[model samples]
Target: MQTSPPDPDDLALFRDFVAGTRPLEQDKIAPVVKRSKQKRPAATSNSSTAEKLFFFSDEFEVFAETQGTLSYVQNGDDPHLAGRLRRGELEPQVVLDLHGMTAQQAKTELAGLLNYCEQQQLNCACVVHGKGLGILARKVPNWLIQHPNVRAFHTAPRSWGKHGALLLLLKINQSTEQQFRELTRR
Candidate 1:
């Protein structure tokens, strides 16, 4: 007895069923994904103090509410600092640039500058520290960043010196100057 060959239509139908069960081609699946709706994350509510901006100084640290942490912090935090700097509260003083100065140099120079700013009752001063020579010199420039007399050493605005300089808000001894006058009179 001889077995009959399958029908042409049945053979075609079986081939199609086998192909369908096999892993789909990547290109075919990509188009299906493109047509599907993409679910996105919902926007988070603005609800925390850390999300707001913060400002601090040697003598004070003021926590203020702000819409964004990226805004101009100097003016937004305390108008007093900006006002005094603009009004020349410490202009009569001197500015010392310690760009290439070592840690020891910065320490020595800073002491002298602070004393001078205090004694002379001068205000506006510039301490220019070149953006570190290269990478490995991270904490070197930060010396001035922690000084007490440094009222606010922000990256200077366009009208002021640029990143290469720091505008100090010195805390001088008003009493010392007044005392000098009294001693001279006596």
Candidate 2:
């Protein structure tokens, strides 16, 4: 039996095969390389929807009810917000008492109040849409359902006002919010 050292050509051929320069004879054993990249969650959902709700918004905030998180710039009554509030540079944060007004009146008042609040750059707001008297008398006002400015509103926390009122996450003018952002950054 003749035992000989391996040829240089065989070693080079093996290296080429390992590097994938030469195709494997066994087609089924060939390793698959994924050529395409994955689509982003937002993009896979749709481009139109992507613009509608992105990671952040100047006018609106991303709120997760389950997680109880808010995306708005929080000044936290620190020196910045307190100073702005004192100088009338920022709008006050309070729950508007709309308890007794009829739905029609409430609707009109809502429009006016929202306009005023936004123009003044007020961020924190609460609307007291009281739970109907005694029994389940009526549904939430039709006007509230139709209002355009109301982005996201929900029942107040138990201590503040409960189901009788709602805490409105109001939208502010982009320019006014820019000031808030500046103050926050500073």
Candidate 3:
């Protein structure tokens, strides 16, 4: 089969960028799996009837659930997956920090981050809401519970930010799902 030649202008532009940048030694990034970009997980009408257990009083505070305590939740059917995440067996690929940002700002940024993660087919990410007065820390988990794109989240390990951050496990990418189905069909 015939093929077109590489674009000369693109090659020169790429070369210029590479020449100006320092060499990155083997970041060991994984190849991304292409996926159908679903807008969000469908919030069934049944969600309206779902129990609202995420509430806490204004005087209450947030903290990382202590070790040996269950600290993760997954809406999916995989029961043990959340436990694995909390134990740090499933590491995050990226982190989104909401330290100084206001609640509204954090929410906006998280929405964008979840969408971006979905598009990139990232399975895991972390959201750092520092343990300042605890407002952000408390609200972050509630917001994540409402986020349609998130499959699961847990309190991060001490080195990862302890109660100040959360490690998230996103749903499988649609492309990955399709690939799985195709492979099984054969």
Candidate 4:
């Protein structure tokens, strides 16, 4: 909001307008601000909030929503690690293509692949969601974001499926969780 300074011609009128009001007593009062920790759900194309431009933050950069892409990394993640993936330095051993598959089929296949990878301790994998205005391409990113095993995702390079594909970094916590359960077993 923008406002002009009081005009000399209107100063008398302004003073008369506020003649009945006294000055505020604000000598000792200070305001405290509280920041909310809640995170809003990722906006989609149909969402009303989708047009709001979300700016990048200092801690582990995110430029997806405003840039109209799906790439994201958890806050406090090692920048070098994220940079390695972004720079296409990391190659994924496991790559799954969801072309020609329906949404349900793709989810099931992705789940199976992710579960196998986690059980086998596979850290990096690639998923090709296919191109050309498909629903799977739109939905896959959101699915990847919500998956517990997924740590980060980045757009694949030209040779890898370009924007249609994503490189996923997974958190292999199955073994660690098992060991913890055994240690606390009674």
Each model's C-alpha lDDT?
A: 0.48, 0.49, 0.69, 0.69
What is the clash tally of candidate 1? 3
Candidate 1 residue pairs that clash: 90-123, 90-124, 91-124
* Whole-structure CA lDDT of model 2: 0.49
CA deviation > 4 Å runs, candidate 4? 1-69, 173-186
Please give the distance, in angstroms, between residue 130's alpha carbon in candidate 2 and its true position after superposition: 1.7
Worst 10 residues of 2 by lDDT: 64-73
TM-score of every candidate: 0.41, 0.41, 0.56, 0.55
Ranking, TM-score, top scorer first = 3, 4, 2, 1
lDDT of 1 by residue, 68-151 (tens): 111122333344564444434434246677666775555556656666776667655765555565211233234444455555
TM-score of model number 4: 0.55
* Model 4 lDDT per residue over 15-125, tens place: 889889988887985777877799876744533222211211113222334224456686666545556566777678699999999876776677767877877777778
Model 3, C-alpha of 21: deviation from truth (Å): 49
TM-score of 2: 0.41
Q: After superposition, how far is residue 152 of candidate 1 from its true place, in Å?
A: 2.8
Q: Write the per-residue lDDT of candidate 2 for residues 1-186, one digit (tens) a residue.
A: 998989999999888878846554865766899866876555234463443233222233232131221122233323333233223343337667667787545545565566667677676566666665611112232233333444444445655455565555455777866776797566
Write the number of the candidate with greater TM-score, choosing between 2 and 3: 3
Best candidate, lDDT: 3
